[model samples]
Target chain A: MFIQLVVSGLLLGCIYSLISMGLSLIWGVMGIVNFAHGAFVMLAMYAAYYGDQLLRIDPLLFTPVAILLLFFLGVLVYQIIIQYVVDGPYVSRLLATFGLGFFLINMAQFLWSPNFRTIKESMVHGVWKIGSVMIELPKLASSLGSILVAALVFLFIRKTRTGQAIQAISADKMGAALMGINLKRIAAFSFGLGIACAGAAGSLLATFYYIFPDVASLFGLIALVAVALGGFGSVEGAFLGALILGLVETLGGYYVDPNWKYALMFLIYLGIVLIRPQGLLGRGKV
Target chain B: MMELVRHRRFPTFILLFGLFIALVFPWVVRDRFAQNTAIFVLMYGLMAQAWNIMGGYTGLISVGQVAYFGIGAYTSAFLYTHFGINPWIALLIGGLITALFGVIAGYPVSKLRGRYFSIATIAMAEVMRISFSNWEYVGAARGIQLPIEKESLLTFQFHSSRLPYYYIILFLFIVVNLVVYVLERSRTGFYFRAIRDNEEAAAGLGINRSFYKLLSIGISAFFTALAGSFLTQFSLYVEPDYVFASSISITVAMVAVLGGIGSLGGPILGALVLIPLSEYTRAWLGKQGQGLDLMLYGALIIVFCILEPKGLMGLWKRISTKKRTSP
Candidate 1:
């Protein structure tokens, strides 16, 4: 039973890591915390669901398509809404993204009727059992998929010229501009990539979890906490934070009254915020 | 702080005019709906102002205020049923208790800067929501329902007209604004703004960061809790979801922002515009269109952020100055 819990918990952590990676990446690159991060998650879920039911495209097949669409959406949002307000008040970016999230949630409710949609069966269906332990195949696949993508993203940001340019801008905006990096182009691309990361996670999770307009808020809160835990803009830190948080929540829920698991996670979060506002592995001047 | 309206002579006249309107409103407006709307305006206005103290002045945009709101309401409900305390008196107790909670939350939360603080606030609210929903002692997810008793001032109950509730809330609204007015002029208010503008510079100047931040959150929590307590009494019920929802916190912040953050009359103007718009839209489209009101709010917040992030006060200043120069 314990092994099962640990395995499932780790899988849960993998998904959270992917989601937090997107949010943290955007903030790290552009200094804009996209409050609409969750909305994109919800959008991906809906797209995957519709793709399966209407077009008979399996989520595994639809993931790339949804990701591409979300990327365009991200770039579009940047051009139309975010570009105008990036240099405005501190609250402007927050409010703009918040408004976009709010609009998307409401739009989902209006169009989908606030109904919870579940994909009963998918390409990655059924479970694999070894002796007394049973592992769900879809969950395992999702975890593996997320880990693979996260690894690729890590490599992309570390090993590529574009990634170095993105890092240059994040390190010093004016210095990067002086070094001949296109700040706007890099920022927009990074935003798109960040959104695509979230959409990918959502597409994977939709294969197993219930889909609703409010689902993103739940995952979004967790992602935000993970981001904070790992340091605001530290993608790797967020990933580690998400993993630790997932384990604590799952193991703690099994041991300590189950219902109080979230409270326990929050207590730990508060402790972290109080003790090290810079996060566990982050080196920022908070 | 610079005195409401464009000139120095307007404050007293505006005060008198506002007072006269409030005094004569009940008599002139016999419709219950109108009175109810006015009461909401005052209540929400008070909440927005409370939020402004920390968010606008101190520059702490906490997205977790609804937790304190829920706690205040639940405290009153628990005390009333278990200890036989009047809900009226429970309001003060609830506010005090919630303020204590604010001190606890503010300590760690104040350590965070910028977006980290906001995320922490949201996390704190989620924790509160989950805890309340699962705790059976407070009736859990079913919530607490205060049975309507005999009409009496002691119980904060009156059935003849909406006048009693209106006046009580109105009184609180005025008191809160007066407190803010005083705070804005005091040394503490100066520190709050200084910390907001530059934390290290303020610290170098000897303004205590965590202390003033706590003070702001404490005052903000007190009024928010008081409002929540009154809401429980007025509605005869207390529910975790209703009081602890994120939307309430966001709405309170949005109201302050729309009116003009850190300004004296900002919340009042914001509540006046938003509450009515919300009430009318919800009344019309909540049932027919489903989530249309929320969509409107979302679009408006975005537009306001892009066009006039400083809110109505900013718009007013531009127009007034433009007229002065053009003429």
Candidate 2:
């Protein structure tokens, strides 16, 4: 039972890591917490659901399509709204994205009717039992896919030139500009890429989780906590932080009470943040 | 003479005029919808004013103020339901308890800076919400519902009319505003601004940073709890979700921000504008469950944030300055 719980927790954590990594990327590069991130995730879920229902496309195949769609949406959001407030005070940035989030959520409700949806005939289904442990196929597939995507993202940031350019910009904006990097272009790309990660995760989530306009609030908030837990702006930290949250949530739910899992996560987050405001692997003053 | 009249006498005249209008508003309006809107304005205005002290003046940027609000609601509900205590007294105890919780929460939380502080506040509220949802003592997710009593000042319920509720909230709003008005010019107020503007500089000048922050949050919590207690008595219900939801905190923050954070009359102005608009929109267009009102509200917030970060007060300042410099 413990092993099954651990395995499921790990699987859940991997998906959470995927979600937080997107948030972390945006925060690391732009110093803005995108409040609309969850809204963006909601969009991806709908996209996957509709793509399956309308076009007969499987969610697995639609993952890349969702990513592409969100990438453009991210870039458009930057050009239209975020860029204007990028240089403003923290309050303005926070309110701008918060408002965007509010707008997106309500607009979604208006258009989509606030109904809970699911991909009924997805490619992944059933369960596999491995030596007294049962693992759901969809969960296993999504986790593996998340791991692969995370690895790709890690490599993209570390090895590629554009990725290194993103690094330079995050490290020192003026320095990166002086180094002849196109600051505007890179920033927009980074924003798009960050949201694209949400797209991937959202599609994966739609397979097993119920989809609704407000579902963004659930995953979005949890992702925010995971990012903070790992230390803001640190991709690796967010990954680990999400894993810890997943394990704690599952184990806490099993051991204590399922209702108390979210509370436990929040308490752990508060304790860690109070003791080390910079997070588990973050640096400098909070 | 003209400058003095414009700067000082005009404001005093406006104040007296506004006061007279407010005093006679319920009697003159006589519409239940309008009265409800007025009550909401006053209630939100008071709560936002409380938020302004910690978030606007002190620059703590908490998004979990609903924690204090929920605490106040539950405290008053518990006292009234279980002990058969007068709600007026319960209001006081709720305020005191919520203030204590604020200080306790602030001790560790106030150490963090900027976004970290904001997220921690969120976590703090989330913990409260989740815990309250599961704890059977407080009725768990079902929440505690206040039994309806005879309408009176002591009971804090106004069954016959919404007038008493309006007057009570109005008085609370005025008192809170006056407190903020005095706090704005006081020595502690200066410390709050200094810490907000530059904590390092404030510390350099020998100011105890965390103490003032804690004080601000404590005072803010007290007043916020009063509003919460008022809500319980007014609505005759206390639920974990409604009271502890992050939306309450956001709305309160929006009120302060929209009206002009750190300003005396800003929250009142924000509430005056926002509450009526929201109520009217919800009444008119929200019947179909389409969130048109919220969508517009969100768009307005984005536009305001992008175009005028300092909010309506900033716009007022710009207009006044432009007029002064035009000649």
The 0-to-1 C-alpha lDDT of every candidate, in the order given, reads: 0.85, 0.87
- Model 2 TM: 0.96
- Candidate 2 lDDT tens digits, B151-185: 88878887999989988888988899789878987
Question: Runs in model 2 with CA error above 4 Å?
Answer: B1-13
Q: Lowest-scoring 10 consecutive residues by lDDT in candidate 2 chain B?
A: B4-13
| Model 2: CAPRI class | medium
lDDT of 2 at A249: 83
CA RMSD for every model? 2.3, 2.4
Per-residue CA lDDT of model 2 for A1-286, tens digit only, reads 8998889999999999998998999887889898788888899999999999999988777888998999999999889998898998787788788889889889999999888878886798999999999999998988888888788888999999999999998899899999999988998999999999999999888888899998887787888889888898788889889998999888999998899998888888888887788999997777
Fnat, 2 decimals, each candidate: 0.73, 0.85
Chain A (alone) TM-scores for all candidate structures: 0.95, 0.97
